[model samples]
Target chain A: MVKAVINGIPIEVEEGVTILDAARKAQINIPTLCKHPDLTSSASCGICVVKLKKNNRMFRACCTPIEEGMEIITHDPEIIEIRRTVVELILSNHPNDCLKCGRNNNCELQKLVADFGIREEHFDKFVRDIPKDSSTGTIVLEASKCIKCGRCVDVCQNMQDVWALSFLERGIHTRISPAGDIKLADSPCVRCGQCSEHCPTGAIFEFDETSKVWEGLMDPEKYCVVQIAPAVRVSIGESFGFQPGVNLTKKTYALLRRLGFKAVFDTSFGADVTIMEEASEFVERFVHKKGTLPLITTCCPAWVDFMEKFHPDMIDHFSSCKSPHEIMGVLSKTYFAREKKIDPEKVFMVSIMPCTAKKYEITRTDEMFASGYQDIDVVLTTRELARMVKQAGLDFAQLPEEEPDHVLGDYTGGGVIFGATGGVMEAALRTAYYLVTEKQFPKVEFENVRGLKGVKETSIKIDDTKVNIAIAHGLSNVEYVLNKIREAKKNNQPMPYHFIEVMACPGGCVGGGGQPYGVTDAIRTLRSKGLYAHDDAMKLRCSHDNPFVQKLYNEFLGKPLGKRSHELLHTDYKARPVYRK
Target chain B: METSVVPDIANVVEKWKDKKGNLIMILHEIQNQYGYVPREISFQLSKLLDVPLARIYEVLTFYNYFKLKPPGKYTVSVCMGTACYLKGAPELLEELHHILGIKEGETTKDGMFQLEIVRCLGCCGLAPVVKIGNKIYGGLKRSDIVNLLSQYSKEGAPVAQPV
Candidate 1:
């Protein structure tokens, strides 16, 4: 440990700790850019400069380490001017289009300017050119609007463990660019929306597919059938100014009805079906290790794509079960069409989701078209639905709560949990436990597995055979745990997990990239609370209790992982190329 | 271990090559497999594929995702994801930059600490996160990044560049 004085207050910090960290330990706030606690520091912003005791030199606190007897002055007037000057220089090249930008009020640069009371600007704005990059389906980058804070660049390159953005050029010419200066659409961006999700300004914005959905709605000939995912009901309330955990499921259903959708359905019902197929597969794999050892969940398309591209060797580990949205699309077009006595071609199935990856998921060639067309037609984000509600001039909060149409809307708690990080694992467990033990599983909560946190791993013994379950939310966490498993192999140890669930976004669907932006852990917890609250309110908490799935097994699919199940619900994967970097 | 197609580069390598400027995704896949995405395959992707070499090179250089050079045996990518940043990525990133001087996308000359910055990596619970290759060192502090890098010293931690 090194003893250091930060901001004139003497504090003890561990050896090798940076001055910024030391300041943090001493409760001294140091503003910074190109530096994040979650990412490796670059110290490029020079915003965190502080005066060192002996040398009297102001150095970036992020890169400087604490010496045993070093003195640091964090907020000295000279230090303040240095920061203010840096801020001014950044603003000089940055676009001042805050009012119309998406992140206007929430922008970091705006907040910093106000925080520092920096009003004077002298540099010419025409020196640097900023353009909007909209190649990616879900996000746009307005380079001019960026303060070069590198928050977006940091998130894309470091946080997600998917490097899709970087700083191009040097000094004043430095700017963020996607690969090869290509539009985002051409890159392997995955449309996770993390960059926009973290952008301090309107630089990164979500691509609104609302107008297209609205166009289709105005076209009366189109029988638009909307399927709301489990996470949407909880998150949609936020757009309407409701509390985070509030249940707007009924209100959402009613709003969709007023908006002119022909039928309102629950993705939970599809999740129920997914659980049926997944649990049965789990039992077969666990008992026999016959198929993919350590079966990985396929519910998150982002994880599936990642594995396909990078970890194809682990492909067999994933259950071939399609996610609830795709399953619902197929069933709605097929079973629902037959039930309604309508041609499947006439019905358009759309998914209301908390995910941006679903956009790419639907584009996959394997996504079915039971009606002999694309199984799902268009996907709207939770935010997009809220926008459409606003555009329709409807007050979502005032709308009376109502239930979804019968058959497809009815579901269980097991299905609702699919929106959470470990929800899929927990859902699969509810049924897998029963099938594996040949008796009712003791614990229903699976309390060990449920949380809005990142990576969670646990093992349970079923009939004396221990089954390990690992759950990871978001890409970086997933990458870590997966590597741990690989390290175990290198160490000559057997694999640790038997089943793994990976959600591309944080907190699973509740913190989806396409959900409301500005959601923190506190907000994610509120939504997660809504998930469990909704679960507890339900009569059937387990997937096996889903009568529809039972009926499907009794009628369409003979059994789980059966010949029909393989043909309808199962799919394969492909390996992808790594980036040269 | 035999590097069969660099870890994760599967059949879809060809498809990624087909899409112009898809080098970003291709680089991600390659990085996933080999711990560090190599330029050899990236060059191959450009020559045999529709994407122009200049475009591919520019893409590799532009995006933090596409590394134009070989990666060290271990790559430490810190997630400055929004959640992590709100928590503490800025602090973590600072120490890493200082410890390894090549900036966000550059690798150490010794090929030890190939520091990269990735976007959102999903673990808000474990904010201030750093993934050295596939191993995630979560709830990170400045010391943690240094310690993790030091562990690779036998393999090699980057020696600081002389002023």
Candidate 2:
């Protein structure tokens, strides 16, 4: 342990702990812009500098390790002045139109400027004239607002292993862009939006589509309906001043009704249906040997895009089931519209998702149009939903708890847990075990396939049959899993596992690229715990036990993977070139 | 979009295939052979190295030396060193720009001459020097640029050696 005195508060921390962390332990606030809890510190911003008494040298607290007996003055008059100057310099290059920015009041740099009492620009304003790139249609690249923090680049290249973004030039000329100065849509971007999630400013953000939803809502002819994803229920509370893990599922349904939606549904219901289709598919493949082993889940659109581009060879292994929201969209248009005697063309379906990639997934293939119209008309991120709620002048916290529309809103514990990493595997296994052994498993909860680990491996036995399963989240962690499979295939070795799940974001949808900002592991765990807690409190914990899903299957779709289910619930994949021609 | 690799570039890739820091080394070889890196070659290299095209472009763009396009047949380098700048080199550069119809580091429309601003050519004594191809012209006036460039523009013109 290393002992340090931060602002006269003596604290002891681990040897390799940064001074910033040490000061944090001592309750000394050292402001940082470039350093995020989820990313390694690049120390690009000078705001976290602290004064050392022993050597009398100012060091960047974020990157410097705390030494024994080191007297660190994290906040002195001189240090404040220096930090204030740094903020001013950053402001000089940044556009002062904060109100027009998407980040606006939530920007870290803006927060620092306000905290430092910066009233005016001290230096001449010299903002770059880079035009925004919205080619991907999922995230926008407003390069002019970037402060060269390197967080987005780090997340994109190192964390995600999607080298679609990089520091193209050097020094003042340096800007984050795709390799070859190509449009992001043409680049190997997977539309994951992690870059936007990691960005400290509005330089990277989800392409706002709230106005489009408003247009649909205001149109008297359009029957606008909205559905909330499983992750959004736990995550959207952060924007309304609630803790990260607070479940606001009921409140959100009430809030959406207040916003003038004709009907509100739950994507968890769609997740339950997905499990019905996916679990049966697994049984058909694993039991009957009809398809390839190690059926990789394709619920996360980002993971699907990544597979289509990087690991196209594994296309055969990917499950043909559509994502939960997409399933909800198609069903809402076809079944809901037909049952209610409403025109399918007038049914404008919007999905409130914790993912930016869902925006792209809505129109990914012809299967998305299986309802004879665009299944999902609009997709709003959890952050965007928060904005829409605020715009509607509704106090989300004070909203009365309510239930979703009964026809397609009810969900099971298996459905709700789909928000977290290894959740889909657990959910699938619950139903797959039943499908295989013709009996409900003794324990519904699979403890092994849980948590924020990048790669999770476990095996479950159904009677005498042992089923090997592997779950991986975050795109970078996927390479290791793929390589192992590749090596086995090359050497004619036995297949590693019977099932695999991949979510592009680290902690699944809870840590999605479009969730509330300032997300760390603590926040992700809390948000995931919220879903798990919701699961535990539920009476029906398995997907097959979801009565509404069973009702849908009985009333409309004959059975899982039947002609009707195949038409609406399942989709296909094709190999795609990473870059545009 | 051309997936077919040139034999020369393939040879270059094979030569540096086993070595570390081979990307830059192979890029240097390609640049030397073709005078500048081509888009097609970069695509081929990206496929050969199993590296992302963005990574190769990042490295190519970061360094001032690498060029992404083919250079002109002749390069007209105006020395912009302190000595040359003090000796009316800017006017000489302007004259060349006017005559060639191209900016610094850009080739002419006809692909005949490329204009560039260079630093000290180790001939400070001969300030306001202009180097065209291998030959250096010292003590030059703004008016002399048009005449000097005309000598290289004509088809099958005999180029003078360095003096």
lDDT per prediction?
Answer: 0.76, 0.91
Where does model 2 exceed 4 Å of error? B2-5, B86-103, B122-131, B134-163
Off by over 4 Å in 1: A1-87, A111-121, A126-131, A183-186, A452-454, A479-494, A555-558, A579-581, B1-163
Instruction: Report the number of backbone clashes for model 1.
Output: 60
lDDT of 2 by residue, A105-150 (tens): 8999989988989887769988888889999999999998999999
The fraction of reference interface contacts (C-alpha pairs within 8 A across chains A and B) present in each candidate is 0.18, 0.89
lDDT of 1: 0.76
Displacement of residue A464 (Cα, Å) in model 2 is 2.1
Q: Which ten residues in a row are the worst by lDDT in model 1 chain A?
A: A363-372
Best by DockQ: 2
Alpha carbon lDDT of residue A136, candidate 2? Answer: 90
Highest TM-score scorer:
2
DockQ of each: 0.08, 0.68
Best by lDDT: 2
